[model samples]
Target: MKIAIIGGGPGGYVAAIKAAQMGAEVVLIEKEYIGGTCLNTGCIPTKVLLHSTEIYHQLRNEAEDLGLEINDLKVNWRNLLTRKELVATQLVEGVKNILRTMNVEVVRGYAKFTSTKTIEVSLTAGGKRSISFDKAIVATGSKSIIIPVPGHDLEGVITSREAMSLEEIPESICIVGGGVIGVEFANIYSNLGTQITIIEMLPELVANMDQEIVNSLEEALLTKGVKVYKSAKVLRIDRSGKELQVTAQLGDDPFQVIAEKVIMATGRKPSGDGLGLEEIGVKVDRGAIQVDRLFKTDVDNIYAIGDCTGGVQLAHVASASGLMVAELIMGERMAMDFRTIPYCVYTNPELASVGLTERDAVMKGYKIKVGKFPMYGNGKSVITGNVRGMVKIIADENTGEVLGVHIAGNSATELIASGAVAMRLEATVQELITTIYAHPTVGEAIHEAAESVFGRAIHIP
Candidate 1:
């Protein structure tokens, strides 16, 4: 069996490897470097910078409390970005090595479907070629959304990609969106001593998360001196001498903020264009490809996954989708369930969640009970002096079946994995409470929160 995968991202690359492992001859095509945007430009690069900034901030601020005296430590932007680039490059090379080891044929080009089973590849090195495959997978991901506002094309205005590779960190930046990308960049810049002003048209930041977690994140941002403007619409951006002036309307009043740079972190849209998907009879909706439960497109032998499918834009989710599609192609039938997929934001007090939120559970008509334990009650959090959030568990009131878990605190991203496993196994609140959690660990909060469901958390009361 010959399989052709387009877009060499987490979805495409993983699909290729899995298909190869399943005894299929696989060809992976990529236009740019491997590891895709997640490793090259988005997730990995951003996290590298965030990690550096977090360490810088922690050492600078927490050193006194830890009885360590340090002086005049500042961020070296050039060196820091160089390290980020090195990390991304190394990971890309690692992916390439893995693909090579799996014996997946990697074609460097842009793929356009000529027919249901044939595609024309416009080679990046300057030649056109065609290939026919028994099956194909489209994993074309997404690109940053650029909002249309006056003067947006002016100098100093940039997207997340450009923001990551900035020659030097700007003294101040006004981020235009308050979603995950925007808030994360806000934290990154603020931690590095860059004045950050976030202008969000929504009523709150990261509106997709639980309201309580959002509140905690908002409070943390405020404490870090991030100026937040919610429910404000950007009217225009203007070049004012050396700085950029962002004009926004709050209520009936219009105001301006001057910053060295402007970052447009509005969101991302599926990048399914230029591939002739619709021309080949595959369904494309609002820039995203439509796929069935098995990751199969409207066409029988073609499958789509990741950001292109518009189901979930997360990298891990894309990898999971890839694996499921590979299995289906190998004659093992299965469907991908996204309900328990974890969502994480790598902030100082990280935010992570899996399964339904409390609001979602109630909306779905489930009678739910909520258990919340503040991080301050966790011994490890108290010992580390980084207790600024809580762990929340939502369960079916009558059945005690765990419905969801939301966490906002140190190592929250790692802590949410246990919650994900519980949800996947349909584990109940009682089961979680009965599970032993090692003392003085961040994970104990999960246990304490489960106990809190029964109003029996020992730490607080």
Candidate 2:
């Protein structure tokens, strides 16, 4: 069988590899570099900076605790970006190596369907070709949403991609969205000593996340001096000398902001625009491609995954979707279970959650009991001096089954997976509470939270 995967992102690349392993002749088409936006710009690159900012912040807080005196420490933006680029390059090369080792043919170019069974490729390095395949996967991912406000094309205004390769850090930045990407950038730049003010049209930042988690990170951002504006409409933007003049309406008065640079993290939509989805007999519901439970579009022998499908724009979600599609191609029947998928916020006090929230459980008609555990009560949290978070678990009140787990604090992002897996396996609160946790670790918070479900918390009063 001949398989063609378009857009070498997490989904496309993973699908290509899995197709190859399943003994199919695969051709992976990439528009620019391999790994698409995730490695080249989005998930991996931002995470690289997030790690650096985390370490930088840690060192600043550690000097007193570790009793090491230092002076005049400042972030070298050049060095920091250099490291991010290096990491991105390494991962890009790694993905290419995986493809080559698996004998998957990689065509570097933009892919669009000229017919139901043929795709045209326009190479970045100057070549045009066409490939005929028996099967194809569309995973073109997404691009930043650009608005038609005045001065939209100003040199200082940039998207998430341009924001990643910034040659120099700006003195002050005005981000146009207070969603996940916007807030993440706010934290990254603020920690790197860039003045950041996040403006959101919504009532709160990360309006999609659970309200409890949102409140937690909001407090953290305020403590770190990030200026947040909510429910404000941006009217226009113009370049004024060496800065950007942004005109926004906050209630009655027209609020003006002057910043050295502007970033539009206003969210992204399916970049399936111009791909000729309509011309090729593909159906698009709204801005995203329509897909069934198995990621199959209306057309047979054609599959769509990742950002193009638009259910969840997360990299891991795309990866999981890829695996599910691969399994379906192998004649396995399964649904993409997102109940155990974890979400993380990389701020100073990290926020992470898996499964339903207490409110979600209630909305779903589950009579639930909540377990709460504070980090201040844990020995490791106090010893490490990062005692500013909590773990809470919601469980079925009558059946004693764990419904969902929510966390806000350090390393909670990595810890919630345990709770998520238990939830998936239908593990009761008693099962997790009885499970052995290692001594002197933050993960023990799970046990404490579970214990508190029945008002038997040992660590906290």
Candidate 3:
């Protein structure tokens, strides 16, 4: 079978490689660059910067706590950005090499669907070609949403893409949304000694999240001197002189906040722009390409995945969806299972979770018990002087099956894989309690949290 995969994100490229390995001739059409936004702008770039900022902050601020002394700690923005660019470039080349090694015909062009079965490719090299494929996968991802507030077209207003690739760190920044991207950048810049003010239209940061988690994060943000204002709507942006004046709803009248730079992190929507999926009868719901349970679109032999499908705009979700579509097209039966996909927010005391939250369980009418362990009670957390978070787990009170796990503190994300698997396998809290956790490690916090559900917490009541 001949297959064409459009967009070279984690979803698109993976789908291409998998289909090739399955003994099908695969062609990948990428109009811009391969590896798409996840590698170039979204996931990998931000994470790389986050890690760098983390190291800078740790060495400058926490070195004293760790018994290391340094004076005049400074951040070199030029060198740091160069390093980020180097890492991103290396990864991009690595992806191109992988595609070449996989024998997936890499077409540098825009893919336009002329019909359900035929797509016209306009080459970036100034030519046109036509390709007919038995199956096609569309993994074109999403882009950041910029609101239509006035003066948005001005000079200092930019999206997350521009924010991540900043020429130099802005002296002061006002992030226009308090969602994942906004909050993460807030934490990063705040730690790096840049003035940050986060404005959220919702009542809480990560408002769609569990209130407890948001409370903890809000506390941390407040402690870090981040000016967080929620339940506020941005009215307009007026560029005056060297500053961008943000006029937001201040109850009755308007209030003004002027900043050196402004980041728009309202949300992300499907980026099917200029791909020509509509020119061929492929249906897109509110700019997102709609897909079925098997990752198939309304058009037969066509598939859509990742942010384009609009379920969860996560890198892992896209990767899994791409792989599933590949397997499905390879004459194999595969279903996308999202029972316990882990989600993370990289913050000071990182937030991580899998499966349902306590509120989610209750709203769904599940009678559940909860277990919680504060990092202050953990030997490792106290010893390392990172005692600023907790481990929370929810489970069915009657059956003891684990319902969800949420953690904040060092390596919270890494600790969640076990929780995800346990949730998937329906492991009970009792089983968690029985599991041996090595002392003086974050892993033990998981076990201790489980012990809390039954009112037998060793470290805390």
Q: Tens-digit lDDT track for model 2 on 316-435?
A: 888888777766776666576777888877776778888888878989999999998988888787777778878899999999898888888778878878977888889999998889
Q: What is the lDDT of candidate 2?
A: 0.85
Better of 1 and 3 by TM-score: 1
* Tens digit of per-residue lDDT, candidate 1, span 359-402: 99999999999999999888899888889999999999999999
Clashing pairs for predicted structure model 2, backbone only: none
Model 2 clashing-pair count: 0
Tens digits of lDDT, candidate 3, 114-179: 888888999999989999999999988888888999888889898988988788788899999999
TM-score of 3: 0.97
Ranking by lDDT: 1, 3, 2
Candidate 1 regions exceeding 4 Å error are none
Q: Which sections of candidate 3 miss by over 4 Å? A: none
Pairs of colliding residues, candidate 3: none
How accurate locally is residue 274 in candidate 2, as Cα lDDT from 0 to 100? 69
lDDT score of residue 4 within candidate 1: 92
Model 2 is weakest, by summed lDDT over 10 consecutive residues, at: 327-336
| Candidate number achieving the greatest TM-score relative to the actual structure | 1
